[model samples]
Target: MVLRLNIDQIEPATRDWICKVQIVEIGRPRESLDKKCTFQNLILEDEQECQIRAVMYTDEIEQYVSTLKLFNTYLISTAKVKVSLTSYGKPIHRFYWILDKETVIEEIKPSDEVEKPLSPPNKLTITSFDRIPHLMVDSTAEIDVLAVVLHCGPQKTAGRSHHKCREITLCDNQQNQFLFTLWEDFGEIEGHEIYSKMATQRDLLVILGRSIGISTYQGLSLQTRYNSTVRVNPNYPQAVALLNWAKQNKTMLLSSPSDTTSTSSSITPMIVTPSGQQLLSIADISSAASMGVFCVNAEMAILDEFQDFCVLECSGCKQKKRTKDRKDFHCPKCNRKTSLVPRCSFQIDLIDNTATTTASISAELGEKLLSMTAEDIFDITCTKRQSLSLNPVHEMLSTKVFDIQLRKSSWTSSNTTTTTLSILSYMEKQHPPQSTTDRTSKKIKPLEISEVEVMPTTAAAAPSNAVGKLQPPTPTKKV
Candidate 1:
């Protein structure tokens, strides 16, 4: 039933392929043509290194995926061969296999006849957040980044296709912070472990591979590409160095014993109460020793006019919707006629009398602040021909002092450092501050590297000794 063929012998007309292959990498399943498609890149050995791209479109995609476990050899048969298309995301191989419902795959038994596995096409280099801006704009350069987990957002279904993603905060040694997004398969499964680790105050190290994505909404965010893996608290030197740095520099400023700890992570504001965490005035925030999350009591000075506040989002990809006809919205990405979802984007200026800064808040949080969804707000502002003045928002927040938690992140470009502050949380009622004696410093325990998940069967699996020498880790066991 298996017609074993060499990689060079296969042609586009080949209908069946029975070959021994070691699964190199598995791409997260992506939705296409209203159906989910899974892709896996495999390695085959000959006089020279060769690769094969395998795709599954059948309903048994999950079953097939489980069979082609990473690093495991398989005897795949009846797979239809085809010339790889440049539009199929980005492929590492020139030829691809289309496995429909009729294809057969079986685990290759361990024997001397089986050839040695070939290394995957990965150079595993750990990069810094500061260097991200200099990288080639549209190149498929696989780079790795290591950072500390700051905050993990609730899993939200996104895009016009309604795919799920969990947004998280990651910070580096330079105190630079960036947003990292975990897509659908990861959001549903591995993301819970990351959330738990943060809640428990566990020192978690995150390493992302081949993530090069830029967005206007979240500046300099990292996205997981095909075959990429997220490793938490990996047993590597960089992880240890980061842990030591975090433990030593958890607080941004070196404060007096009586002063409140200036934390880079989340800080519950202690305002209007005899409390634990000391509150910093808006002017005092910029002068603090380090860059991180800060808490302050500030009133809304001015709300920007609502001229382009609300935009139409495509129901399929969640991208901005455009149209020639006002009644019908079209998605440029999905190329489909889709329903429009209204969302808000606000740039509100806040002032505590001591200082002023502009904070950019996305539509979801804007909805909470205004107590109205973007759709509802749009109707009142545009549908009714109401003035673009943000009188309603101003009236709600003006003169009302709020205990606000702000995250201060900085990045350097062109030999200049630029700092930006974004609101994390705010409360109308002040909460008591925590006492320094009540706080417990977390200890970094030496991780058993063996407990880390099995590495991919590639050079990326090499031991990490120095910076940029990172290997993708297996999923952490749920705590």
Candidate 2:
């Protein structure tokens, strides 16, 4: 008989010991940049409910990846134990195991005791939204949060690889709203479920983000890291409290002043994004304009080296499409047959003598200004995997002044409303300067070469193969 060990008892010094563990969660298989290595992690919990991470790689991945079932108790032995390089955003265990060919995995008999099945960790503590900022100060720290689902964004493919990504907003008891990104499997599976349910059961669901990774980049947002956990409507007690809190504050949670008004919204509050186009300076931008479009002259720069400038949007509802396969999918929100089309939507900053302001540019106007359609840009950036940031045409366009048509807009965050501007259209404030290559464009010939010669005659009889060719109506004679 072999000696058995608990997960917490296994260490590097332990030898020839078997551990009975139930697979709690299976992580997504990850591939190396070179494609030479592939690996996945299985979170295992022992009888004491202590957890550890076990990894399987390459050929071993092909052999047993499908054989293992979640929450199934198995006896694992002879796996290599190693110290964890980084502990943040992973299992609490200080060590992890690497399974190899010598490893033996056998299912435990049904009559024997199984530690637990489908049970979330008991130690998870929900952090209040107010403290999220404090956690951000330590990038290495992981956070657990419980919040109500407020809004869901359409799925978007990023980079040339088209890695799937989706964004959703959540609200907490403090009424703070924050954007969280669901990536990889979270985006493909859970994101769609949340979005579909949102149509009918909008305010009912509360989410628990366990071991979530935080980012301070554009703003504070939550994201999923490798082996991160996200549970929707989990049976946790906090889920109940958050759901009740959400229902009680449903009025405040779902209210949007921008939704009620068109063209412009009043200065009245909670992130005002006036739909009207206006401008002057980014810093001076405020609801005081309650105005129409305005112009500004500024040196422009494409802040991002490369990014998706457009997304597939439903023609009917105008919401972003979240499906991975865009060829054929229905928009559940509109409950109608709809097709996806490229929409012109991107942000850029313009700096004038006074201040620099970032603004949004829409389709028809942006296409005219850039001389490149949204569809073409999407193909180049996301399909062809090319960077437009350094293109000569874009560089030259940035050198010219812009007649920016601004629109007022507002965004609600942390329960506060602030006004912002968007661009309805933009064009060169002055005629574009002549290029050196166009020097001979306006030169005229010395001869009377401008006159055109007109040559026309009745066409010959059509060939047998030209059956569908028009006969020009035989030039019908007057009555």
Best by TM-score: 2
Residues 294-329, candidate 1: write the lDDT tens digits: 567666533335334566655566555443123655
Give me the runs in candidate 1 sitting further than 4 Å from their true place. Answer: 1-21, 27-33, 36-52, 59-66, 74-79, 83-89, 99-128, 135-148, 156-164, 171-176, 183-186, 209-212, 224-479
Candidate lDDT scores, in order, read 0.52, 0.58
Off by over 4 Å in 2: 58-67, 87-91, 108-110, 113-121, 157-164, 183-189, 200-203, 237-252, 256-479
Candidate 2 lDDT by residue in tens digits, 1-479: 56788988889988889987777667657765468999887778787888777888988888886678776778899789999866455456789999888999887656656642334444445677656644554656777788888777678653223367777777776655556788867888878888888877746578877668876321346777666667677655667777888888788777732122122221111111112224455334432333223445455544543444666766554556544234756667557676776664555555555455455554444444445666776677666766554476456755576555444433333443334445533444456434312211221211111123312111111001101111101122222
Question: Clashing residue pairs, candidate 1?
Answer: 126-468, 159-317, 159-318, 160-315, 160-316, 160-317, 160-318, 161-316, 276-433, 276-434
- My TM-score estimates for the predictions, one after another, are 0.42, 0.48
